[model samples]
Target: MTTKPAIIILSASALAMAARLATELDGEVHGLRKRIGDDAEVTFDDVAAHLVGLFREGRPIVALMAAGAVIRLLAPHLGDKTREPPVIAVAEDGSAVVPLLGGHHGANEMARRIAGLVDGFAAITTVGDIKFGVALDQPPEGWALANPETAKQVMADLVAGASARLEGDAPWLADSALPLSEDGGIALLASDENVNTPVSGLLYRPKRLVLGIGCERGCDPAEVLALAKESLSEAGLSAEAVGLVASIDVKADEAALHHVARHLGCPVRFFDAATLEAEAPRLINPSEIVFSEVGCHGVAEGAALAAVGASGELAAPKRKSRRATCAIGRAPHPFTESDLPGRGRGRLFVVGIGPGSDGWRSPEVSQMVAASTDLVGYSLYLDLLGPLAKGKVRHDFDLGKEEARVRHAMELAGEGRSVALVCSGDAGIYAMATLVFELLDKADGPEGLSDGARRIEIAVSPGISALQAAAARVGAPLGHDFCTISLSDLLTPWEDIKRRVRAAGEGDFVIAFYNPVSKKRRTQLAWARDQLLEHRPASSPVILATNLGREGETIRVVPLGDLNVDDVDMLTVVVVGSSNSSTVATGDGRTWVYTPRGYARKEGTAMTNSFSGDAA
Candidate 1:
């Protein structure tokens, strides 16, 4: 197969599923190594050998296709240093679907993603898997190969009453672990149905949950099930593993959440609209319509949170999602107000320094920085904020040292000082604002930071995330729900990054990619470009911005097919417009881009005015 549309090599059944998904998504798929003879078979080994060659050739691999043998054979080759492509495992009988590796770090995620491409459900069987609602070790992708000794460690931790904090919406869902303390500082809780009672440790009752949910008007059953699965994935818990189902009264009769309830084998309780309306205090951006119609800002989100909070379950970290995979858990004890006593409120501002110029820096941001007594940030980012740093205590650190920076800022803030943790561009868009609140979720971590550390209040001020600056410099490309994906596989693994790229492609959302490529990280951008090619036309516009809002900035708008990989690096930001964003060249060498809002295409629209008193 030439890999037109997308090149996929898998079992016949998987191929069939892929074909169906391509049709549903209005895309195409090409299968490599199709069976030719009667009773012929394509095993995992054949696919692995083909992939090894492909990887060596520096060709992009969206996902791998195999049965059981692929990961085993690929294991030795996939040493600690090398990066593996996304892997999706197919049963010979097509009875089950498995996302075996990189669930979040990327492989398993790829399989689940392919299943999405084919519009098929992956038969996830991991225990405490948030999507399927199973245990962490039981996750399908890693189960076959996870170390025998590691299981003992996990069990030992659980037996010792430690908390397992599931972070993302992966089938292999969960981050690091924290042992529940005997002094009641932290407690342990289960995200699955199989709860084990340890002999001596304190069961940490953490009170937070990240709910991954999808619902339709009046509750379409499938949407509910999808929502439930997503909620489990978001919360890093299993759907069948939930303690209860809290939803709006309208969905009480809705078949899907009910089906999910049955699948979870849990009780479903309907919350009145008033109850949801009253929960506004617990919500960040509660919807009036949702509260009026469904009786809750987030039925699935609220339900998951309520279940965990009431049970004193540990809170999971926050994750980003197109839908509402909100994290709600028990409020940290002594949840003091931001304006408490002598200390300045725990404020987190995602300050955007407006490109590289001091002129573009918002006055509000400057004042806030001046007003703060302590500063926290990457060394380079701190260098940019030097004007506001004249008298403040600086906590400069290297790149990728985010968690420590946040903790120090909080510790400083708790010590009664106004603190500002700085990030370039928009603070909230892929910045420190998120990390501040993530640290606030004391329930989930390698270990809970000291209570004094958790007392800091956090707030996020908006800053420009490179996309806005790049768009304006080129043209109006971000006039819609565009997303920003960092291509750096340092903190986030490449496999997860690829899955997100595929999702963005499938959703047809405009994309602004940060940290697009580096010398050692050449393949990611190419892989991302190849994946985008599957859904978007090769002629789609790509805007490359090097040193945006800074001196020596170079901006180029080119067709996706003609994008030059050499043009990007750590200093560059890549803007890939959605299908709607278009390019038009002027009489000169310059080109301009714009996204149409579709208002011009409306029928029965009149140009003449017919107001209350129109005299012509």
Candidate 2:
């Protein structure tokens, strides 16, 4: 069974039962925020909606709820079986477990595991799964079936106690636990050839080939794709068997190469010049011209061998066109995505988890965190992630130890582990993403580390920024131009911060002040107000939003002159409106702060088609 992390969704009453299963399976527990999930790291307001989202995200769900409830929740979002995420619902009392979806994609196995833990029966429905103890469609990790339609009938034949010859060169299939009848009508053919499936047989395609491509600087994507398809067809190689498309690192970002790979439905892999050159002696046709241009004699041949490793041999030599060349390499064994290193580049996700609230966080941030193997952040930020950090190896540091935290994350990514350097709110805004690039700029490049850490891939997954949350709490105070300046002088100079704040004031821009004040730094907020007062009116709307999207959250708007510096803290994001801003009292006697997008001048002019119907 694939050991992917699971999301355990249970009710308030079943928290105790969930605790045992969650620990056993290393699942993230989710329950109602006010009722259950006190023991869970994350809590939800709507259990069914949250479960639906998690299921779509491909997370293995262990729903400890009624089967009817699980079905009702998933009814609307149920998609193709090929794309559905695994979902298994267990009885609240741990008496019955049902695999509701993605059985072919491991739901059956997950259900069985869950059932065993609860000492209950797993209601497995697939007869082929129970009888032959296998799913033919689910080949071994490195293999795939070319046509699943034929595999269905063959599976039925196996379930009905009929098996014919295991054709081609797959020993595992020959020795399969399937009931063997030497001359039975059913058959399973494993090969890379283009096969026409018979009435009683299935064609299994082994992921054993790598296609290496070399192209001119601006090769046409269509031509490259056509070449790839035609070459595969002429060579009698199934496109499904091509595990990857590889080329030299110089073509790593080549749009044509990527387009061709995408059109062929295979992942693109790249080898550095040095790695490709090392495979020179094995190239069928070495060329001095090609070597001079790309530092490699044969990009197609070298990359193909490198992708498939030492045991692989070239199935076809480089076939040339005016603008592109191609070669095919066959691996001794089938290759899985894990077996092929597309590039030896590690990935680092600099994520912002938002203001410690699951509802306020973005789906992208959640997925990036889930995909990461390691979580790197300040202790508080990691703690805020709750159960999202459950299975990840967390490297937590104190508040100000950002350099250590970021460096540790980069180094972990260098070792080819998917690392998430998490932060609160937007990572680019006064967070770790900028610091990550700064360190990379100073490195001696990838050669600095024995494992080449500088080549580590970095991405920034944005969160619902504090200013955005604060702005939306009231009316749109930031509907017009706005600028943000941090009041903290830890890394930035106080004078520089003041200059930015002054510019915002002079431009009549709405200003959001981050890290406004701490215990020791008391005077900056007051000083900023005085500086802003020089340009604007004293009655300007000042929104003090503290602990946004978190417990004890408070959002209140007061006049600029009434703003108390002592009331602000590092957790607060204070949005000060521009000169055009205004405050209005609603029916409930609550005032809303707003800065018009551009309609302040146009408001009095009015319109002929006004909804209030005052056409004069």
Top of the candidates by lDDT: 2
Tens digit per residue, CA lDDT, model 1, 1-616? 1111223445455555554544443323334444421111112335666556544433324342554565665566664322434445554333445764434334344446556554556855443243333333333421221122344355455645555433212222233333223343222233232234333322221212223233564555555556546545655453333434445444433455556656654444444455545545555545666565665675544543443444343344323343333333432221122211112223444465656455456656765675677888888787776434655788898876888887777777655467888888887777777777777776356765554455444556666667888888877878767888989888898889989999999998888888888778898888889899888877678888887766688887777876778877788899887776777656775676666564435786422111111100
Worst 10 residues of 2 by lDDT: 607-616
**Residue 220 in model 1: lDDT:** 54
List runs of model 1 lying over 4 Å from the truth.
1-350, 443-446, 587-589, 599-616
Model 2 local distance difference test score: 0.80
Number of clashes recorded per candidate:
52, 0
lDDT of 2 by residue, 1-616 (tens): 2234454555567877777887887666677776763566557787777887777777788888788888998999987778887788888888998998888888898788888888999999987778766788877666787778777777876776676777788766766678766676777788887777656687788878888999998898877877877778888888888878899876754677778767656777788889989899899988899999989899988988888888888888888877998889898888776667557346799999888788777778877887788999988889888777777898889988888888889889876678999999999988888988888877766533323456676788898889999988887888789989889998799999889988889999999999899889999999999999899887788899989888899987777877799888778899988887877667886667777767756856631211111100
